[model samples]
Target chain A: MSNEQDSVSDILEDNTYKYGFTTDVESETFAKGLNEDVIRAISKKKEEPQFMLDFRLKAFAKWKTMKEPEWPNVHYPKIDFQNISYYSAPKQKKKLQSLDEVDPEVMRTFEKLGIPLDEQKKLANVAVDAVFDSVSVATTHKKKLMEVGIIFCPISEALKEYPELVEEYLGTVVPVGDNYYAALNSAVFTDGSFVYIPPDTISPMEISTYFRINTEETGQFERTLIICAENSYVSYLEGCTAPQFDTNQLHAAVVELVTMENAEIKYSTVQNWYAGDKETGKGGIYNFVTKRGKCQGDNSKISWTQVETGSAITWKYPSCILQGDNTTGEFYSVALTNGHMQADTGTKMIHLGKNTRSSIISKGISADYSSNSYRGQVKVGKNASNARNYSQCDSMLVGDKCSAHTFPYIETANSSVQVEHEAATSKISEEQLFYFESRGISRENAIEAVISGFCKEVFKQLPMEFAVEAQKLLTLKLEDSVG
Target chain B: MLEIKDLHAGFDGNEIVKGISLTINKGEIHAVMGPNGSGKSTLAKILSGHPSYEATSGEILFEGKNLLEMEAEKRSLAGIFMGFQYPVEVPGVNNAEFLRMAHNARRVSAGEEEIDPLDFDDLLSEKMKTLGMEKKYKERNLNDGFSGGEKKKNEILQMAILEPKLSILDETDSGLDIDALRVVAEGVNKLRTENNALILITHYQRLLDYIKPDFVHVLSNGKIVKSGDKALALELESQGYDWVTTAN
Candidate 1:
């Protein structure tokens, strides 16, 4: 028994989150609290146009009138919005024209995170927009992307360079008053990626945004928007990580995508935020995100594939609206929770167009004392004749102490719609482990094989490089989960 | 190559393989026949280092090494293979990939380079051909949705890939049709060599008809009651196990 105890401790010690170290750099952060003055100051700091400020003011008013919903399957202490600094950014002297002008300390941080932003080390065929705290530091492959009539830059830069496009499609999909966190994000969101693909042209390379949260007490509010014009296609990737802190940090981000006629937008995210301490669960990120895409034109498609493996309490549902005839919407996700983490995530497919089709495949893995839930909704409007939806949510438990739940809601206004939902819960039994061990495979490798197999469908939807990273990340996170 | 002395093991504090002693050597095939609840499966499990079975007071030496002290995977890496009566189905894990991982584990332990997937595919194809298995089994998940016969054949397929020095087949003939049993038995026979040993645990002598064993032992109440050559199996099949238990 003592030897068993020692081995368990060894596993726990070796499984510490690797990206918990904070980078020491000079930063300028706003005072703790949210008010009209803070919003005005944020706009003034970026020299935003009047309409942008008015948009913030309207969102703030709506946010003040709304209350944080208490419906998610997660429990935590009340968040003191007044105690959070809504804006934080690394202090920079002047605008930079190249990675050379960026701070070396910040550059080293991204490099350590395996996302090199410098010219010599930048990833080939993939442009990156590296965001630290509340601002985007550097964007790679801007010239090459610009050659094809593509606009890939930070939202702050887009606000100045292409304000017309931003205003035209900013909150069209997810309105300002969509939800509590989304409304708050709309009010004080600092920086995120902005992508615009032109008509009849496919982007030459993948566009990615790597977000890192460094400041301890400041909340991260990032708003990302991607728009695909007629007959165009684009695939975007997002990766996020935060430094470990004893006090939980809030990260409320909103991502919206719009696809026009004969266009498609594929969005993938591999979120590995700090999930607090595994024992006491004292600190981690409180991720409350709202992401949705709209298929606004005939024959358009929108797909969301996410691998969520972090955050102490994750409440997110990346959804889609099939608004045009013959449109398609897909959501493939693999969310894993360990330690004292809790995640309630899934997707929503609203079919309003004739012959629209949607599919949802979500895999949730829970270990330790975590709680994982899959909540999804499939709705078909009266006019959506021949609408179809298929959803399958599977949950795998690593130990007896963890739990899994599924809540699926379906509504159909017309009798012609077809909807299907399937859910299964399974445990990684001792027998299964023994079977692998008796075959010469170590327990760690066995768990890796089983988990990677479980996530294969969702992983296949990710980009090539991102799928590899997601596999490795899942393996590392589940090291100490099994006995 | 293998020796067990006064092996006393069981799960949940209930002694099942009580006071069992047996010795197996290279190039020899031993058939341990027994009735239901006579500890046939328990002995096989204890030999392979199953976690649930605790060896209370006994010693198992595999090539002069303390087999009881090794973990289940370590025992496997040390060249011991157990063909389960009920092979576990691992969904979503490709069968060929699982075989490759098992094979590579042995190679890495012997300080040899791991076989790449392309080369492994060739090896697997050849092994499957010898077993009369279809190529689709290579792409399917490990035993997921496989029939009983298919599962048994898969066990033999793994044996061919791992190439263990000592193999224990626990009731491998059960639940297998005549055709599958013949294919599986033939597969096992082809892998037998002078440097490797085999132990077949069975309730009936039907399997011994295909692959003749050099030695036969009858177990009752966790102890070997009788030991003989191939004639013993035929005699037991004819006269039944009651006579052997009464005589012992």
Candidate 2:
């Protein structure tokens, strides 16, 4: 078993990042810098309304007054903001009327990534908004979605068609100045998906967005907003990948969800950005994201399910604010870090109304020299009588070099609230692997079985198609980390 | 169908199994009884191809194939199974699903089509029923949160599912109650076939009473001091291992 472990570690040391190929397409990029002029240029480039510009200016002003947070349990060299290109997009001759008008090079790039945007190979039931670099290149099933009274398109298109709706709920959930990354995203976010499910209606099909970062030095700041009206339900998924570069790239994204009376929103993310060089950890995406949802009406629900298996460094906390009586909030996450990667991610559930409830299940798997942590908070306010919260965080360490940590905070001002938190740290033992082997299962299959079991609770929350893909993605990421 | 010659195995530069020679034929059940630290378990580990336990100098042949040269999983796929004394608890892995995986591994190795979940479920249900295991065992995690007796039963259930040609039961009867002991022994008895052999490593003669052994060997100080029929087990139980070790 020890010999096998040694060989496993050796293989992991040589594990390659697969999605590291850059697309060959002409791109229009901004000069490397950040300032008021850059914010104005970005807003102007999108041809936004005056209110949008005002929003960006406000966020930029707030961002100037704030500083990058360093409290997360990760370490990296200081980021020179002025050295990163704020925006980059593939050059487009004109607005695309259909997938046929998409550039062949960009289409081939997406096809290579297993996300075909062409009509002949589009995902059957998933309406995808494929964002290339800094702009959405194509949005499939828009006509079908519109017939069902559902609004699904890029945020830039939504701003042009329905500026009032965008203005009303853009930063309502996560404020413009909520955090450093959120503020930056608000100021320079190029393109992301916008979803609006009207009252008394469920989405006809699953809505998803595939984000691809091609340029080496450009920063990707995409914004996603979902609005579920009264008695409505919507499930949204997002997947991201980036080309490998020797210089680290920045990806600061913001996602907000608004659920009205009796509405439900399910948001899932499978982030597989290029995770630098396995041995040197030279280049990868710095994923800093802020995602939050608000249960604004009674009996509303919000669920967040995320699988983080990429990115060199990740600092994200998808949270929920239960502000309505009898509302529910749920979070399920599987964050895996390998080969010099570091991730500090979890959720926050704030119970602010009577009879509010929340459940959190987080599983972190760390391999090689990576670091994985689960930081979560559950807060019940004085008015939140009968509030309940249950949190369980488990970590699995693959080798002796990797590390895992859990930080859970629970605060309740009301005595009637009930909060339960359970945490456990486990290792993939040689004995366990031997047990599987003695039963005829190979070591690789043994590791996969154990990992899938560890992440079962979280994977079950994902949509059917995504659950299978997520399982494969996890196996691919941890392929050589263990025997 | 299994042969071990002068197997001197140990871990961390310390030889625990000084020298063991044994041959098991089809339809034969061999019982090895010894006190603590007598290397009974080490022999089982060496046979199972555990990496930590190195065979300093030995030869193990299973079906005329060099077993020491094969990886643990390859050894298993070649019709060798080991029932661990302490079954590992794999949380969230469904027991039925795990059984199917192991069974499918063998099937694939033998160039057969994998059995679907529905058919596998029926087969597993029948096996569990024969072992007196409750239906909940199918849905529960593999050996996770299972009691001592339940863990032992799960090992046997896996053995029943895989149906390996040679099974080395390393203290499968340990920590089992009387009722559980009977169920386990009956389960083993039903699995016995002319094409398969069983090696039961035990520290007590009590297990021998339930499932009679064709050959009983008394091991002391890493060497088999006495070898005989089932009567030797009764003699050892009555006179204890003191007489055999003293005479040797």
Candidate 3:
């Protein structure tokens, strides 16, 4: 290795995860184990109907028989599923009458996390559902949405008031038997945002959710579902932050989206979970999430954009089921793992209808001793004649100790399928750093600029409010990788 | 403007520069002509505080401050700029954004306000016009796929925008044709004032034909062995370095 690379590697080794502070609020924490009784208690605690209870029971049974997946290019000690607590909700959580009724403490925490609760204080026209611990504390712009025949509320509330919509769409894109983590999420998901845009009416505001995992020794299982009727359009974004802790916390979330004919949905997330410390890799969130969207009708569209910079270990593949003719799907993601963080994330596109199209652009960055990988698959069904899929996955490494890997799979049963795959792996050259530094740019800023440039394409796809946020987050996460 | 005393440096543990020392003055242009592997590039890299070139024994004073004690960027902020021979290709970084950021960095260090994007565009356009660069170059990635001549022109353009007091051009004329060399030299010449100095490191005297140098120094093996007027560069261009290296 070059002398410069050696020093950069040393510099990267000294960085610690910054957003690791635990809130002292009391939570109705569950017992540190998983079972039928535990699952039933969670369902009952949420006041879910019998069908939801039965669904949880069946999912729990299925989860019990399934084994943990180990195919991802990541390494961690085996997760003790039974030892993990299934739920933890803030004790003060209750049906909030208004945003003013939200606990002042929760409001303060969100403010410190850079999430604004006051509607007028928001930088963009986004309606946020702030989820603290295991419950949604406040959801903004609900009355205005209701005026437009739009349904935007907590999924738990939707399950109670709009049970049919919840039942018909929940687990439809990502079934309970989808994977081990998805099955577990289906059984014990506490609360998440729900959105239903009525036909032919565009959402007046960008819907969003801000999830904060505050307590220790608890797992967060949130199930989010979005349904858009014909000719409707909605753009949604989600952000997450967690405090530092010594013990690893489990976060298994399931998000599903359904769009009808001519409907469009744009979903984005900027996740900065508390990665473990720098030395021993202790006290980080283990984020295993299952997110998928389905184009259920002709000419429908769905786009997923995410910037993941945190989590000790992340295994997620936000996918698209292109089931409608002439429908289009997109996945644009930038996943950066610094310190000892490990992330194996990408997306899957399943083309099932004639003339369907999908595009994937994923960028991964690894710094310090972290390992980041991109595992993606593109599939074309036999009847999906003239289907087109294009994917490009790139990885960037900052230090000599880090590693980047890319694994892409393409399976086409039809002969007319048009699929393109492009992949590359690179390291920040010392010459590049020197070139910037020689012009009065600090080493950290130079590194940040290079990375921001690498992720320009994906960042432009994010909501205007979050494109700048994602850029700043990437700089903070990789600042230590340069001297 | 700058003083270097007994500078000895190299990569890893081997000393590529063995006790080479020289002093530079404001308003003066010093051309250090040398062959390949004569430690010319090493000197430039060391002056820029590149992590690779370790200075074992040296004292470089820039405006009465110990230049070696500062980091690379601090040295830059203190008015030292290196016009790289082979400019690094940053693929996705836009040229206009990169120049604006560099401009803003100096401004911020001087406690001046940052230029807004709209105003920065005007300033960048003005500079590009002065350098005879195309408007589309602003949108292109920073030297990513630029030709050799274009890359050299970019270095000079950066030097013009940064307006450093001490500029070191390391073989900035190596790959340029006559017209590009003249354009690049004109940009450097336009930026030079009585308060600034220039160090042009080159192998051939072709660039010196355009950008006149006040003093010419011959560096071989590691240290400067000959110091003369611009006539020395003209002599070396015809007779080559043996006339100097063998003379010593």
Candidate 4:
């Protein structure tokens, strides 16, 4: 890299790694390995109910029988299950009551990430849950949320407090054996955020969950379930961060969302886990997640937006099943891959009812030796008469060495459905850069402004806080890769 | 206030501009007329510090500063602007916002008060009106779907807003209609003052009719072979550039 590019990379790395802090919290960690006995031990440790244990054992059996998927367009060394620790939770998490009771080092990590749980409490408009490793340390805005018939708590606590609700909806949409990663998540999942919006209610504020993975050689298995009742609306945001390491880590999560009649659910993610070395590609997270939402009643809507700029190898496709007539779905995303990163991310819009409609806008930026792809599918069943869908997938390549690809699959069983898909791939032109530089803009600033513009459609879909962070992350990833 | 001494510039040492020298006073407008491949655009690109053009041996003094040593953006900050023949399209970036950024970059370098959004809106509106452009054009992406005339007008609008000390218009009037040419010339004329100079490089005399130049130079074989006053443009129009080539 040139000296100027090196400086740019330094600035980006410094900003993105602000939350890479290590805490000294006492923790109960499992041994580094995997087996049926280990899965049974985890079930016993969680003190899970009999049916839940049976469900987990069945998932484990399925996972054991299934082989790893080889169709993600990613390359990596074999993942030896015996080398990965399945569970680790901070010991102080059991004693946490309020934001003040949380560990200072852990709280400082949130502060460095520009999210102060105490301040969020004061705002009274945002409910926050901070998840470290396999446990949720603190949850705020509980009182206000409780007053409105809303149930917002950790998944572990929710499973204990509301077993009936959990049993009714758990694994209904995205079953344990839905995919390889989802099956793995079902077997040894530890903790995640859970939210339920009651009927005839408009959620007054946005709820967010910030996830951190700190333990070495361990995997984070978070399961998020959200149920929005009839005429209810909720917007939820998820943020993830991890410290730098020279050894590969694993993250397998499952997120299931249900929206009833006239209900709307907006789910956004800002994923910024640590990426491995740029030269040797020594370490980073191998994130494989399955997230899906279902519109179960008429006039319901689900919108999924994400900004992904981390992980050495990322494979996630948050999808929507439009089962209700006149239901709507939208997915806007900006996925960036730098250094030795590889990302294969897009959404599946399944139109199962009449008059269903979906729109997708995906923008991918690849720099350095990275590879980025947008793999999307739109399926219109025969019952989905007159369904309408529009998709625009664009990829921008920063350097000559990087690659971007688009794989769009469209299936229509109903001849009356309207489907239009557009795809484009382009690189930054020398003339364009020269034009901007000739107008007194620096090279870095010019590139940044251009990228920001390219991602404007997707960034506007995120919440205010995540939008800002996503913009900064975009610049950081682009700079680091080019440098 | 610009001087070029024995400029020898080319791409990959082919020497498109063999040896050229010229000087322009602050308020003067000089028109360089030549046939195709006569190195008129090459000279303008070199003046604007295009990286593709390598100066084999030359010295460009802008306000008594060594212009060749500075970067392209720094040269722009030092008061130089070029209206390209085919302006670039920057998708998803609002035209007004980009102009404001460029304008502020220059202002910040000059130790002047930077322009806020409100002030910039006002300034941009007035300039658009002077260029006879619609108000709604500001919110659209920069040159994304602009026609040939609109693109040239937009370039002229940027020139008007930037108001650089030295402005080079390379074939800015190539695809413009009579009315666009008039409005563009008017915008250029309004930006001209005692402190700014203009270089209008064109093959035809149509643009010079609207904004007369102090000197008209006919370039042939990478060198300016003849120089005259305003009438030379009309002469070249009545008699094609072949006349200058045959006379030489």
Candidate 5:
């Protein structure tokens, strides 16, 4: 078994990053660098409304006063903001009427990514909005979604077709001054998915988006906002990957979800960014994202489930703000880091209303020169009487060379509130490996089975198809680790 | 069914099994009895292709093939089964699922169709019944929180599921209570067939009273000092291991 594991590691060490190829689709790319003028150019290029331009200006001005945060447990070379192109778009000559009108090269890339854009074979009950680089290339199942009074489309298109709706809810949850990365995303985010489930109606299909960063020397900043009206329910999923490069690419995304009275929102992410070469860590994606959902009305619920396996350096925290009485919030995550990858991720649950409840389950796996950290906080305000929170963070270290850390903060002002936190760290025991191998399971399969067991709780929270995909994605990322 | 030729196995740098020769025919139960550190367990581990315990020299023949050349998983598919004394807990792997996978892996190797989950669950429940196990044991993580007796019973269940040609039980009776010992022995008794063989490595003659070995071998200082029929086990139990060690 040990010999089998060593051979796998050797093969992975000599292999290249699988998703590191370029797609030659003609795109309208902007000049590199950022400034007030560049921000204005992006706003004009999108043909934005005056209020939209004002929103960008306010976020850009706030972003200038902020410093890059260094408190996360991940380490990376300083990002030169001046070196990155702020905006890049796949140039479509005209409005595409159908899937065939889209660029075939980019379409083929999606096929390789296992996202069959063809409507007939598209994942059942899923409405997809494919975003390439800085713009949404196609939106599928739009008519069906529209018929049910649900609005699902690119945020770019939403700003034009329904500016009043976009203007009312854009920054209501995550304002421009939320964080360093959130401010930058609000200022320059080119495109992402927008979902609105109307009051009293459950969305017939899950809303999904496939985000790809194609152009080199460019930064991708996408903003996603999902609003569930009073007494409604919705499920949203986002998957991301980027072409590998020798230089680290910047990806700062902001996702905000708002649920009203008796409404529920389920959001999931499978992040598979390019994690540079195994040796030297010369290139990869610098993923610094801020995701937060607000349970604003009584009896509302918001749940976040993420499977993060890529990114050379990841510093993201998907959080929830319980602001209404009897609101419920949950965060389930599985973050795997291998081969020089570093991730600092978890979630925050803040309770401000009476009887609010939250639960967080995080599983972190580190293998082969990787470092994974889980940092989270749960706070109950003075008025939040009887608020409850339960948090569990389990870390699995695959090899001796990797590292895992956990940090938890809990604050309660009301004595009536309850908070329970449990954490455990373990190594993949040699005994377990030998046991599986002796039972006729190959070493690779043994490792995969162990990991899948470790992350089962989090995977159960994802949609059925995505749960399987997340498992397969985790196996692909941790294929090289062993005893 | 199995042959070991002057086996010279060791761990790290120290030689544990200096040199030993053994053979067993189908339908036979051979008891390898020894005091602590007599290399009985190490011999069982080596037969199952343990990564540690290098076979410094000598050869092992399973049926007609060189068993030493096969990987651990391949040897398992080749009908070798080892019941561990202290089976490690795999916290998230479902017990029934693990059994089905091992069963299918062997079936696939022999060009047989894999059993479906429904059929597997029914078959597993029937086997668990034979071992006096609850149906809920199938839903649990493999031996994650099992009692000592339960872990040993799980090994028996695995052996029953695989129905291997050769089985080496390494001190399986160490932690069993009287009741569990009876159940486990009964389970093993049901698995014996003319085409299969069993090697029971034990510290006492108590287990042989239930399962009944065809031959008894006394091991001292990594070598088999005496080989006899079942009567020798009762004699060793009454005389104590000191007599055997001193005699060698």
Candidate 6:
């Protein structure tokens, strides 16, 4: 059995450096910079409404007053926000009415990321909205989704036809003044998928948004808003990947979710960013984002599951605020950091109403001098009587050079609430590896298998497409250390 | 056939198996009996290409191939299987799914087509019956909450399904009752063939009573000190490993 693990680990070690290829997409990227003019120009290019202009201006004002958060346990060279291009789009000569009309360059980029733009493309049994840089390039299986009265489209279009619905849900969960990145996202966000499941409806298909970074020096700021009306159900998955590059890039995005009475929302993310330089740490991505969901009505539920395996620096926490009686919130995460990358992430479950419940399971893996941390807070308010919360955070270190930390904060103002937290840190055992290797799995495949098993709890939450991609992403991040 | 030529191995630079040499031909069952901490498990691990065992000096050859040079999985693909003393539990990975994956990995490496789900189901059912396992065991997580005996039986089931040329059982009877021990031994015996080889590592002669080893060796202080026919196992069973440790 130990031999089996060793064999599996060997297989993973050889194939771990994938997702390092850049696509030859014909993109029209702006100059490397950001300012009031850049923000205004982006809005002008999108042909924004007057109200949107005002919203952008207000968000910019708030962003100007907000300081970059220093609390996250990540270290990257100071991001010169002024040097990042705020907008970039592919060079498509025509407005694409279908996948055929979309540029081949755009299609190739999606294909390279394993998201083909073909009409028959089936990814993990979910409909995909492949967004490259700042634009939604192509959508898959729209006709089938439309049949269920599920509105899944780019946020820009959602603001047009479903204006009332968008207006009501937008900024309701994550307001413009939520945080530094959220404010910046509000000011210059480009395009993201907007999903609306009508009352009493269970979406027949899983909705996904695949983000790819194409041009250099461009910051991809996408804002996603999903609303599940009363008695509605929806599961949404988001996946992001970028080519290996030598210059650090910026990706700041915001995602907000709202679940009304008796509604349930499950959101999952698989983040595989290029983890810049392993030697000098010259490039990669600085991913700072805000994501939150609110249970606004009684009996509503919100769950967040994330598998993070990439990026030079990641500082995002998808949280849930239980504001209604009998509401439930959950967060499950598996974060892997290799090379010189660092990730400070977890979740916040705020119990504000009576009888609210929350559960959190966090797993962090650190290899090759990387540092990973799981910092979370679960707060039960005074009115949150009879609330229950449970948290389990575990960390696995692949090598002696890496570090994993767990910092959980629990506060209960109501004595009737029950909160329990547990944490454990361990390394891949030599005995475990030997057991697998003897069974004939290569060392790399064994490590991959073990790591994959370590993350199974969170990976199962991802959509089929993202799950495969996540597994591959983890393989790449931990490949070199398997031996 | 397998050959160990003066193999010196250890962990963290501390020698566990100083200098050991052994050879087992096809269709033979070899048993190595040792006391606790006598390097019995270490030898089994080294044979399976475990990375921790730094073969300081020596070589292992499996079927004319440099066994030490091959990766763990390659060894398995080359018809080597190790039944663990204590199996690792992989949560969320179904037992049947893991078995199929392991089976297909070897098949692919051998340039053979993978078994489809239907074929796998049939193969699994047959093996399960030999190990006294129910069909439902296939869907459960790999040894997630399996009892000690069940885990050992599951290892035998894996060996039966894989049908490797060389099978290494490391203390497979450690925590099993008499009934479970007999069941596992029977499964091993059922899978035995002229083209296959078996290496059983145990602390007592009780398992030898069922599997009936062709050769029995006494291992002490990281070296095999005595070798004889099956009667040697009975002598050790009557005397004890301590006697052999001091006799050497």
Question: What level of docking quality does candidate 4 show?
Answer: acceptable
- Residue by residue across A217-296, what tens digits does model 5's lDDT show? 88999989899999999989999989978889999999999999999999999999998877777789999999999999
For the predicted complex of model 6, DockQ is: 0.35
lDDT of 4 by residue, A239-331 (tens): 898888889889999999999999999999999888787677778889899999999999999999999988999999999999999999999
Please provide, for model 3 over A417-463, each residue's C-alpha lDDT reduced to its tens digit, 9 standing for 90 to 100.
Answer: 99999988777776788889889987777877898899988999987
Model 2: lDDT of residue A239? 93
Q: What overall lDDT goes with each candidate model? A: 0.93, 0.91, 0.88, 0.86, 0.89, 0.84
Cα lDDT tens digits, model 2, B86-200, are: 9989887888889999999999999999998899989998998887778888889989999988998888899899998999999988899998998889989988889899999
Please write out the lDDT profile of model 6 over residues B1-248, one tens digit for every residue.
89999988888888988788999999999999888888898898788776666677888889888887777767888899989888987654578877887888788888899899899989899888866777767878777789998899889888987899999999999999999999989989999999899999999889998999999988888998999999999998888777788977
Query: How displaced is residue B178 in candidate 4, in Å?
Result: 5.4
Cα displacement (Å) at residue A2, model 2: 11
Chain A TM-score vs. truth, each candidate: 0.98, 0.97, 0.95, 0.95, 0.97, 0.94
How do the residues B149-225 of candidate 1 rate in per-residue lDDT, one tens digit apiece? 99999999999999999999999999988999999999999999999999999999999999899999999999999
For the second chain, the TM-scores of the candidates in order are 0.98, 0.98, 0.97, 0.97, 0.97, 0.97
| Candidate 2: regions farther than 4 A off | A1-15, B177-179, B220-226, B235-248
A145-217: candidate 1 lDDT, tens digit per residue: 9999999999999999999999999999999999999999999999999999999989989999999999999
lDDT of 6 at B45: 77
lDDT (tens digit, per residue) of candidate 6 on A99-176: 777888778777877777696665647889888899888788777777878889888777767877877777878888
Runs in model 3 with CA error above 4 Å? A1-16, A93-95, A98-103, A118-124, B11-13, B116-119, B176-183, B186-195, B237-243
Ranking by lDDT: 1, 2, 5, 3, 4, 6
lDDT of 3 by residue, B1-248 (tens): 89999999898898989888899999999999898988999999889888777888878899999887777888889999998888889987899889988999999999999999999888888888887888877888999889999998888888888889999999999888888889898888888899999999999998998889999999998989899999999999889898888888
Q: What is the interface RMSD of candidate 1, in Å?
A: 1.8
What's each prediction's TM-score?
A: 0.94, 0.94, 0.93, 0.91, 0.95, 0.83
Question: Per-chain TM-score of chain B, candidate 2?
Answer: 0.98
